[model samples]
Target: RPAYIGERVVTPRTPADPTADSDKVVWSQTVSLLLGALCEKSWDTEKV
Candidate 1:
């Protein structure tokens, strides 16, 4: 769920960086999604 949400948030920023190449921009969003997922996973795990 956080992956999906983060993807939505990051998707817009992905194309916003005109200074960066397309591949780099895409990679940024991928990283963002991964981080978001990790954060959510950690939070959920801590609750148990």
Candidate 2:
């Protein structure tokens, strides 16, 4: 017999807290900006 329904899988990693520290927020933004810059550079090279 074939199974008709699928089982749900849960992730081991937990979600971040909504009320995170100010330092954590600042660091996250800084890293995001760096990644964005890198992506833009790569995209520009591709267009050339």
Candidate 3:
């Protein structure tokens, strides 16, 4: 877990774990879903 040190959260002290192509695909999908949800909420449907 990451720790908060007053103003900033402490970065990981070790190297990042290796991720495979499948992991990247899943991560991008998750990110796109979150971005889409945010855009939908911010869009004005009545004006569309």
Residue 14 of model 3 has an lDDT of 35
As a whole number from 0 to 100, the lDDT of residue 23 in candidate 3 is 58
| Per-candidate local distance difference test | 0.69, 0.57, 0.55
1 or 2, which is superior by TM-score?
A: 2
Structure candidate 1, residue pairs in collision? none
Task: For model 2, give the 10-residue run with minimal summed lDDT.
Answer: 4-13
Model 2 stretches with alpha carbons more than 4 Å out: 1-20
Candidate 2 structure quality by residue, lDDT tens digits, 3-30: 3212111221233643444445566678
> Which of candidates 1 and 3 is the stronger one according to lDDT?
1
lDDT of 1 by residue, 1-48 (tens): 346644544455556665565555577789878999999999999998
Better of 1 and 3 by TM-score: 1
What is the lDDT for 11 in model 2?
21
What 10-residue stretch in candidate 3 is worst by lDDT? 6-15
TM-score of every candidate relative to the true structure: 0.56, 0.57, 0.50
What TM-score would candidate 1 get against the native?
0.56
lDDT tens readout by residue for model 3, 1-48: 754332131232332633444455566678779989888877867457
